[model samples]
Target: MDRSLDQLRRRLLIHCTPSQAHTAAEIATAHDTGLVVTGASADTIAHRLREKGFDGPILCDADRYSGPRRVDGGRGIRPAWCRRQQELGLVPLTDSGYLEPDNWNALRSILRVAALQRRPVIAMLPLAARWFAESHAVDDLARELDSYGVAVAVAIEHASDPFSVQYVVRHFLRLLRTAQVPVLLLRSDVAALGALCHGAFAAATGTTSSLRHIYPLTSKGIPRAAFPAVFIRHLLSYHRLDTCETVFARTPETSHFWLCDCVVCGGTTPDRLHDSDDQYSVALRHSLHAQLLLHDEIFRHTDTPDQRASAWHEACSHALFVHRQVAEHVPDWRTPAHLKSWHTVTDDPLRGRAGIPAQPTQRSVLFERPAEKWSAHERRGV
Candidate 1:
């Protein structure tokens, strides 16, 4: 997949969990999207890429050396694992530390370990924004990342709130301009998505390639929504921001929304992860459709530049029309009693462990800076 970058116009990144490499490889083949191998034991997962016919680059995780999930409390993001990925020739990516300032130091230590093993594609794990944009410290850190001579990608969030969609898009584009670090923006609102695309489409006349979208998508879970999320990629194409459908491959979870009767849907009646008739199925469909369609509406309904200047106007109309159809066809469902009770019972075991505490306030930070930064450094590069 040397030409993989040319194929994926939108640059899809699929989240692979529960099942890792093999499943990701399967998605790569089906959706023809890029692979981002998340979860622990990423080196092991990466080995499955070629066998599954995935030609695009793989995004290996920082899980093995010393995250909370490490077995035997093994040092997370192991040097050996990173070495293994280098040996296999996979592209690498590390999360930007979040929830606090010092998290960068902690993540930087992990990156140093990988550097010792000669890993490529080193990225900075910046803090995730709750209500504001990336701070000066964050920008300074990105500049430091640039100094390291490696590619940098920063993480940001788009939550389920009223301003979530526009806030992410606007601020993210702004960040890309200020920091020079590649930005990954998450979209969640269909109309806001259309509005964003329309805005970008208008701005695109003077923009360069660096200003285009670099969407790395994942699901809350495989959605059995009204339409397959692939439709979202199509909208991205209209502005040329989401381009290159010829090179990269995406993870299989990309086919999630088109449940049942589809090959990837796992056909067995009882095996259906969310059988259409299951009580959770209706809500499942909504949850799945809600976010993915935001992307889909942009691609499917957003008009091409040649069609008319009222592209966004038409896209909004189409999104509303499709939304109405989804409401009519998909059943009204609620969160299941068992799952809700589990949440109430566990009362959040994950909180303290991941450095998140009960009643977490902004004061409780998830990461602390590393005491040291260098094993010794010359320079690094992509």
Candidate 2:
């Protein structure tokens, strides 16, 4: 590894599927950026990047959802993946994506393995996606992480699941109080991203997108031919809290990713990509390109005071133009015949104004009406 385990730094992880790793690496190499490749398979792609000269960090994903040990833990892919990542000089990005009765046990096991390798963890999700209910050992570990001052990031994957967001929100509050860590709430859905940026929940933020996945809005009005950079501006500005990051989909170059200019793929007259192909090659390419644009923009702009205040508006305007031109189709992931077109609503009293009116006003802040169980939690921890 080029860097050391000296201190914990706030990291921005760009999820690179195995297929897009090469293009992602190309972009990263150009900008001197890194990749957060998920899964054991991700390493194969990361290695290729090194051969091609990528000069950023590579975080091998530790998606140990079922917690540390399964009935056949040794046979699991994660443990071996960790060792392989170390071999390739890659870092570890851990998350508890699995839902289990004893999530803490899995995390502890993962942590134990990580500590042995001296693999510095950038951040972690101690709760389930779209929910905050923690596993058995999560609270205690949160304290441990706090004492060590590790930078923590919580993933709010999908609250739209048949689940609750209350637990996730509550758990995040505890993290805010107990840890002096940067909290990254990942909500890529445009609407959800807007909501997170709207309310008091905007303390710290990060976002992802499917724009490059199945559906991509045209770049007619957006920047880099993708999501309105204003989306990012809104996310960064929504909260008095600063420091915003996003994973955008779309490259400034032709529509295709992987440097592959398949006529039906990335360009205006791209070929028809098959849905059965899990790799989502075109989506992958567009996503990498978009992210490359944003990543460099973020590093150059957000770090500077003047540029952040000045360049933000221009950036948003660019994103909006791109988003307007891209298609609103999300195949398989969304229900068929779904309507995502931009709507213009008039002042009709019978039904609600279901269109994008003038900019939305701020939402009201609601307190945690749930009884104070932290005292009980604290007492038990004590």
Candidate 3:
């Protein structure tokens, strides 16, 4: 790998929409962070970033997997767009078809195109959940991808259920173990951190929920909320601004868990997150910084793969404990199902072998809420 790609390892690639590009550039200028933008905004965003003095690596998502017809939408892959990507200093992604259980032809065609290009090109493979449930398909795909010697970007369709995502993650790790090529997990949320822990070359999460995952476009447009969700690191999930305020208001003493000390937050607590014309920008910067802090913690643990996995598992377990403790006080703040699913998978003994795991655990923890029992400094340590 070259110096630019090398810098991407163990780092969170912030996926920015056209509107968020300026903020991301400001943040990227200070940190060794890579920015991902769609092909539509690639040239403009890259130009703006360069003008703003950010010369780091920029990735352009071809975004060809959403529709069936290649030329149906302007966002789909085209020769002109690919050339534009090259001009903007990006490793062009092929206009690969979305991969389903029976879509071996599409996968093979992408690899063949990568070989013909004779340059470093990322083969973006948008997968369906069925790819994970079918082990034979995953093995075949991984073998073919490894032989091509081209970097791969894997994007899964939106899945509301954790089981659906778990399948994708398990198969993703299998590919990482088998393939020598770099693999990137795109359009993710908290799952991005889990991917980095288990050896993903890079992972991306959007500033808003809609961009966080790949959703099939419907005739009926999905409505986006006025204010984006706030990322609470302690809970390992995103919550609405109103939800955060409610949690803090109900259990004022326990607000320490959600308070952020990142550069964006300074000394301000999450309880003060309210809707304003500028609240979205504040949430976006805070979310990005909070994720960076957690990513740093994971990367700082210089140990073997098993040890890293153990550390991540411990963090998830502690987050779950915090969730339960908060629920004990705030009735409406129940733990999200995906959080429980993440902890369960990390706790499996087989997690060491595959780097990711399946199977669920029924274990439960009973602990007294620590707000009253611990000092402010001690509580911060938790």
lDDT of 2 by residue, 9-117 (tens): 3233355556656655554454344555554476777787778767577755443432223122222224455566667766544433442334545545544543444
What CA RMSD would you report for each candidate?
18.8, 17.0, 7.6
List clashing residue pairs in candidate 3: none
Best by TM-score: 3
Instruction: For candidate 1, write residues 145-181 as lDDT tens digits.
Output: 4545444444332222222344333444444445542
Return model 3's CA RMSD, one decimal.
Answer: 7.6
lDDT, model 3: 0.66
Q: Which candidate should be chosen as best, given lDDT against the real structure?
A: 3
lDDT of 3 at 324: 83
Pick by lDDT: 2 or 3, better one: 3
Error of 2 at 246 (Å): 25
lDDT of each: 0.34, 0.36, 0.66
